[model samples]
Target: MTNKKMRVVTCPLTPNQLHDAQLDLPKNAKAQAKLLAYFETTEEDFVPLKQLREELGVSGQAIQKLVDNGMLQFAEKKVNRDPYAGREFERTEPLALSKEQQAANDEILLAAKEGRPETFLLHGVTGSGKTEIYLQSIAEVLQKGKEAIVLVPEISLTPQMVERFKSRFGDAVAVLHSALSHGEKYDEWRKIERKEAQVVVGARSAIFAPFENLGLIIIDEEHEATYKQEDNPRYHARDVAIWRAKRHHCPVVLGSATPSLESYARATKNVYKLLELKARINQQEMPEVHIIDMREELRSENRTEFSRTLLEKIKERLERNEQTVLLLNKRGYASFVMCRDCGYVVECPNCDISLTYHQATRKMKCHYCGHEERVPEKCPSCESEHIRYFGTGTQKVEESLAKLIPEARVIRMDVDTTRQKGAHEKLLTRFQNGEADILLGTQMIAKGLDFPNITLVGVLNADTMLFLPDFRSAERTFQLLTQVSGRAGRHVLPGEVVVQSYSPEHYSIEYAKMHDYHGFYKHEMLMRHKGAYPPFYFLTLINVSHEEERKVIQTIQDMASFLRTKLGPDSIILGPVPSTISRIKNKYRYQCMIKYKKEPTLKNELKSLLEHYQKEQAKGLTISIDVEPYVLM
Candidate 1:
């Protein structure tokens, strides 16, 4: 619902009049009591009039009579709920940029000044002052009487990022994200709509900020998959930003240390202007990365989650009074529970996946469906009493750290610990204030964090995403490892990184150890080309799901048949097969994959398929189309 202009009513009576009115009590004791309550209890100068009448049980007539007698007075005033109402920032001035940063900033400023709708890929190494270029460019745009929209990954929108923008732009900056309350989002949106805020710093949705004179758009950490909305009305923020930039005749900046393959491909093809910042700011060295083979550790009779090298490094950091950031990328206690005696595993009845054991809750829970059950002593399937938890997670790592180094203060961050409002800020603040020796988390702590004292970074399981069914698993593993590695060695103190992986010799891990993005890109591009994957051929996934498995299959088959008859030989259509998970929340899923270089009629054909299945949808069938999905599963 649109938030219309709201008016507040305030008392204009003096203290003397209030005393006189209280001494001579009005006949409507309830209304008079509410008026006194507001005056005595609330520090707010005004209360919304509608709320006062409805919630405080104040009668309009009683208020009018009180106003007439000069015992009280009411004044209408506009009110807005400011999200950052009580926060104050120390203003910061622009910093002197290096030659590379200055050149990038100049290009961006020129584009904004000339109103050219150009897309520039700012491929800078981590800690290379990419944000400085963004700040200087936005300043130019704001000075030109235009607005800017800056998009950062939701997980990367830490207090540090928000503070830098807020300190620089002050009240002119508006933030939008899913973590904010609906009322707060509405007010922020209205602020932008009313031309009150000139710069919007938010997650993916901020691309659509209602700015009439938009000049510059920046997507930081542009390779992040979080920029894609997976649910209905699905869209990629990068695509939307470029679309809007063209409409407004402005420039869109895609800044990342590791750009997505599709985006980097476009840059290589001259579709986007490529700006490179190879060296780190202030001549700081990139973190020295060490890839430890877990297989060797196993052969040496070591069974701990941490490799010997990582544990030694952690202790070294602790002894030197430094900090460490550990990335696990998993959040629960264990990946699954299994019975060694019978080879039986506990699986979620609602979904086609095993239930994860959350040690804090002492229950096995489904990560996908929210189904929970008590950890059974005996295996439900085999009646075996040898049940055990396997695999590693953030919680498990935290527990291990406590046992290994009792004196090391660790702050564990994940979805569980950061569910509350301001939790992220509070935890990060504590770490920044030297209250914690180690910050352990999942992917959320992987990027956009700048902590000076953190000299050590560890990856407990670098192979977690290395072998997924998805084709981009290698690329994702490389990107994540590279990003997390960048977290250390960002300041005056030198930094080190320890990556533990079962597949230690994998090309992705080897390249990550060398901090070689170009190597990984070249190697991965060949794999993609050989497999006919993204950058070579665009992909579209058409999913059909229903309660009945047969019905789901039939619908996908029918759609596949229709597509084959309509499309030319150049377009390849694969599968009317079950999806990776197959069944989620008791609904069976079937998908058809479309790979084509040019199919002008594909969208219209897909729309017709949806139209044809309108009747089936009413009977519990669901169809979803993802043009360029981040996750195939």
Candidate 2:
């Protein structure tokens, strides 16, 4: 009766875990000699006590005082996914590459000696190391013994990509994320089903890492709309690491720096294989990007959140003590509330919009159904004490940088300051040890933050995700202002990025203030080819949902009339409409979409519209389907 996702936890090794094992586990006697090498192995080695207290960096009250002194027991067992056989990895010397990263590592080492599957598109440019060509192409696929999968786009990029792949593959890196715990993701999915890790750094479900010699698959930031997965098994970790690198024949790569215009139109139609790092690591200088105009700082200094050219570059990086990151693509503490005598606003009765205001939980929330409350001294439909708030976030730029720079010090890093579990590597290791002079956040500190005394970044509000009615909101506001202006200075100082914008002539903020990703991918691929969107039409959507708003418009108008007779007229379709926040926690949505560029029975008509809504989900209805959907809401 208990195969509830294969449980675990069982062991025996007491006498006070072997007499306080060299002073309460002096570096876990190799995780208690792999917990007595799982009782001389077999029963497929029982582990999951939250993966042996996260591989013995102990404490769930020191493993419940070693299971109340008898030294552990309690199992729905099957655990021992062992591998860190007492850490000893050495092979270091890689970093020399840069002659266009050695001609993009000689065309990915001639497509990994032509073993078959290939799909490159690196297009690197944010500090151009692209994690040193993904740790020298996963150290040439761990020198031919194979296995590799990188993935990344956020579990706050799993602690700096698992501390640079466990400082270059020590204990052969294995991490999967939903921030672990499902017994540490079933012990890193049984260390790649017991091959015991040959490098798997995670996030985006490490593209299902149970590799069978999968020689390589990288995807770092690959134009991240959080690498797609928006729910269910919605996949798209870069199309599931190019379908598990074509069933493990090998090479996938994808890395990026603002690259997604459908992977730069499938790497200019060769169907992927375009490298181009084009300078940063040592060829430094891609910063100096100004553009301020907050509508002339709200018409000449009536000012609205800094823009005297970002307070003269945050007062010259706080008198050269250098370090500043600002960016505010929304995060509560403003950007909502409102009334000022019956114009009234304050939304989110279950989510259409506007609620925000969180100033360290003074509450108002509902950044789409989180639904908190309390901050309304009037105006709940106009009892009008003139309530107001309106725009700026990251807790109103950390309380307007402590009331206009009272000797700065900030830190922030959003989602309400890192909700626990190594809070985004402890606020990015205290803003990389300078102990914060200013690092405000949101947009998850906008991509691969490498802080070498972070000279200056200050974006504040570059069209907070450029007015999203979402056609990839101007490619996520030009990839969040070119990855938060490639986190300034990046190494040997020389940086600068102001931005501000009310709409400083928006060609996605003038192609992200001239760091122009191929002029914002040719003006957003001619506005996604005159708004048909995606690399020339391929979206899907569907949605539906109910709690009975006319049965969510008669189940999305009978699935858009059964997807226009199982899709035809060369596709198109569009709406059953009402979605963008059409009732959230209470359901009521609607959608449809389709778009298409040749469907070929669109995945068996979206698996027969999810098995006809699994029998109309017992009459209340629901549905979801997204496919290539980086948000339609």
Candidate 3:
């Protein structure tokens, strides 16, 4: 008390005067002030500098400068806290790498040591030691007393990837993803913020992990659209990673066999350094792609769900004791049940789309909305018994395969089958153990699986996404085809891909068959330039949903009008019309799209509109704002 009184009298203002000033403040403000004053006098019970900085919204440099100027002092000896406090991560030994991996590692280390933030696009083909390169880069950063953040797409939530990281980095690694519980995520976040974890790994959100001394950022599957969150703060993990790396003066590595057009453009323009790993780690050759024209099948009346060529290939793989993967983008038993006599399709009452037939449930269900109805005995339109299922889905494909192979075991992996946790891994494990001869699934089976025995890959309906309305549809189709094709032929045996498409000559399909990214990009970029799509112009999609269709449309129209009035002539607004599907999950949907040319403040303006709309819109209606939405549908 004597020392406190002496110090108070020597200050510019007396303790009594400060107390008087605090007395008239709000309760929370007064409490905060009192806590600060107590900490100054009671050094034995003071908070850490890091905690103080966080609480006061101050920067580390600012706090250090304050201490250097004699305005602040440490209350106790600094103690290191646990970075991975209250988090669980699997621990394992480092993976043994081949010569190719070693070379890649050395190159990355040399780039980092030179203090030049290298933007290396590690175009390592699948099974070409890309993960090893990632580990090597992380090790280099760790040795330099810095941190690394690895961003993987959501589909890579497999135990294999998790185990690999845990074994290599042990306690220094912290994972951040939507899969973690809220408390666990908070603890892991704190660990990273406190500098207890040197390496951070997770899906898209891991890009925001607060690593104090971030030195390296690794973006695996950089071409994945999932990296770009469709909702608010619609940030792309790859883009954000590059931005953060620049901020920290660190190196960024984007690894992918099929890199995004934007990334490819940057690398081509010399904004990013391109590092190509053309061959597989063991020099495995790329899969031989065969185009099975469905047009020919339809003409020959050989379209019994499975094309003859595809069936023959599957049988050959089965006889050879090799595994087979069949990809069908659709998920239900049939796309729709229609009345041939009346020309009526079984449609969802709530949405402007047909209901898909689910054989397991014997019900017609809406893929967009959860609307369901029992399969009708007769046509609901004309009461005629002429209803027939049209189009094929994964369920129909699975059914056909079971009947065709008979002796071979088949497992279907899709949203309907793997809705439960651990089901995805269970299916993959079964297939890997040879318990299933044929693994039929949607896009999930197309990624991150390194099965050497999978000598045959079948893409049913390869043109499904080619005719999509989005400008990036071609790019997406090429990426999916290439990625899925890369999953095969990782071992000694050559692999083959059979693509069944009506439009075999389509640029996307043709480029995919050739595994030609440059060709695809050049062709797609031309279309984008004509249409004024992304990487050329920024886009913001405003979605308004409500139970009442008219109200939703009116609100969106009002928003579009407001934006038009506020924005300059350089900005263009479109929509205030029904969405592609019109309705989803019982809510009528309307959308407004805004396109800006070099407008950095576009996002801010959109955010402000969202905030204002949240307050002005009726209570029953809901509004969702998506910046740079991937799909219009």
lDDT of each: 0.89, 0.77, 0.78
* Cα deviation of 461, candidate 1, in Å: 0.4
Residue-wise C-alpha lDDT for candidate 3, range 520-611, written one tens digit per residue: 88888888888887777778788888888888878888888878878888778887878887787778988888888766666687778778
lDDT of 1 by residue, 385-415 (tens): 8999999878888889999999999999999
My TM-score estimates for the predictions, one after another, are 0.91, 0.32, 0.79
Rank candidates, TM-score, best first: 1, 3, 2
Each prediction's Cα RMSD?
A: 4.3, 27.9, 14.0
What are the runs in model 3 whose C-alpha is more than 4 Å off?
Answer: 1-107, 114-118, 170-172, 179-197, 565-570, 611-614
Per-residue lDDT, model 1, residue 137, is 91
- Pairs of residues clashing in candidate 3: 83-191, 83-196, 91-167, 92-167
Worst 10 residues of 2 by lDDT: 77-86
Better model by TM-score: candidate 2 vs candidate 3: 3
Q: Pick the candidate with the highest TM-score.
A: 1
Instruction: Report the lDDT tens digits of candidate 2 across residue range 1-633.
Output: 111354566666544544544355446445554454443453544677676667656556655555565656666744343323344444466788778887887677667768668999888778888788778877876888987888788887678777777877777688877755566667767767878778888778778777788877888888887777789887778777887778877778888888888888988998888888878978888988888777777778555588776777787888978888888776767878788777878787765777777776687878656778888898878587879788777777677778888788888887767877668888898888888788888878878888788878888778866787888887878888888899888789888888877788888888788877897788788878898878998988888777778877976787788778877786788888898788887777878788889888788977886786787787767787877888888
